[model samples]
Target: MRLMLLIRLIFLLLLNGVVLSYAHAASLAYEFSRVSNNSTEDLGRQLSMLVTEQSGGALFTFSNRLGVPSSITDIYFDDASQPLFSSIAYHSDSGAGVSFDSQAAPANLPGGNVIGFLAGFSGDSSAQSVEGGVATKGVMKNGVNSTDEWVSFLGLWANAGSFDGLIKAFADAHFRVGLHVQAIGLAGRSDSYVNQPSPVPLPAAAWLFASALFGFIVIANRRKV
Candidate 1:
C-alpha cells in the first residue's frame, strides 16, 4: 500500500512538472493559418515557426515542419494584434530566417500585396538577427466578418525591462509600416500572408503520453497486488 501511495505521489509530481513547463515556457508557442485566401503570392509548404523573447525584444524561427530539420525562412509579419500578448516565446532551432528584400508594405498598409513582413527568424539562441520592427492593429481582413493584426520584430528597442518590456515595444509601434516589401516565394506564388488560429496537436500529446504511462503503471500495480 505504501509503495502504491509513493508511486501515485511521483506520478502526480511528474504530471505537474510537465504542465508547469508548458505554463511558463519562455517560447511564444502558437498555431497560425492564413487569415484569408485572398493572397497574391503562392503558398508553399507551410513554414513551421517559433517565437520567443530576447533581452528587450522577441525572436523567431522557421522550419520545414515539426520534428524535421529547420528550413530557411523569409516571410514574417507585424500583425495588427492588440497588446501583443505572448504567454510563451521561442526561437528557431536549426536555420535562422532573414529578409530577402525590402520593398513591399504590409497588407493593412497603403501599398503591398499582402500583410506580412519580409523578415524571418533565426535559431532561438542565434546571434544573427534583424533589428527594428512593426505592428498592425485590427487592420488585417480575417474574412467577411473578422479582422486582425500582427507583430514583426527584428530587434525592437525596449525600455530596459523584462518580458513586459518586449510586449510594450510592440504595443508602442501600433502603426502602419512602410516598405517591408513582400516575402519571397515561387515566381507565381503569393508572398504576403495573413494569420488565423491553427489547430495543431503536438502540445496535447504530452498529456496523452502521460495518461498512457499512468495506465501502464496502474496495470502493473494491480498485477503486483
Candidate 2:
C-alpha cells in the first residue's frame, strides 16, 4: 500500500510538470507602442479600432512610450494577439527625423505565430514633420510625420513543431503580413496600458481527458495495493 501511494505521488508530480512545460512552450510575448496624447479620447478610440481591424482580434492598450524614454505613454496588446518582434523607433530630440534601431525578432518564441504592423499618422500640425519607416538604421521619409503610429501588429504566420523553429523564422526573414487599418492618427489619448502575456486556457476536452487519466491512475494504484 505504501508503495502504491508513492507511485501515485510520482505520477501526479510528472503530470503537473507536463502541464507547466506545455504552458511555457505554447506562447510568445513582445513590447509595442507609439506617440499620443493624454488629455484626449479620440486617439485612444482610433488606435483601438485600427489594431482590432488589422490583427483580427481584440487590441488591448499597454503604454504610450515603450521605446521612447521621454514618451508620455506606450501601448501593448493582450496575450491572445500574436506579437511581432522588432525594436523601438528613435525620433531624435533635435528632430533630425526618426531613427529605428537594428531590430530582429528572437529566434524562439513559445507560440508558432506570425505578426505584421501598420501605423496611422495624426498629431500636432507643427510636429507634423516627424516621420517614420523601416530601414537599416533610420526613418527614410521626412513627410511621414504623424502623432499616432502603428508600432507593432500581430498575426499567425506559420506553424512549427517546436518553439525554437518558430523563433528562427522570425529572426531570418521579413514575411509580408497584412494590416487591419489604413489611418495614422487615433483621435484621443491613453496613458495607462496593459502589457502582460496572455494565458492560454485549457480546453474543456483536454480538461476532461486529464481528469480521466487521473482517475485511471487512481484505480490502477488501488488494484496494486
TM-score of each: 0.42, 0.27
Best by TM-score: 1
Alpha-carbon shift of residue 120 in model 2 (angstroms): 14
Model 1 C-alpha lDDT per residue in residues 154-173, reported as the tens digit of each score? 44432343545433443354
- Provide the clash count, candidate 1: 37
User: What local lDDT score does residue 152 receive in model 2, on the 0 to 100 scale?
Assistant: 33
Q: Locate the minimum summed-lDDT window of 10 residues in model 2.
A: 119-128
Question: Which residue runs does candidate 2 get wrong by more than 4 Å?
Answer: 28-187, 190-225
lDDT by residue for model 2 over 1-225, one digit each (tens)?
Answer: 768767877787677667655544443333322222243332222222111212222222212222211222222222222333222222222234422221222211212232222221111112124334432222222211233332332333233212443333333422111111112235322233221122223354366557757876887777777
Every model's Cα RMSD, please? 11.5, 16.2
- The 0-to-1 C-alpha lDDT of every candidate, in the order given, reads 0.36, 0.30
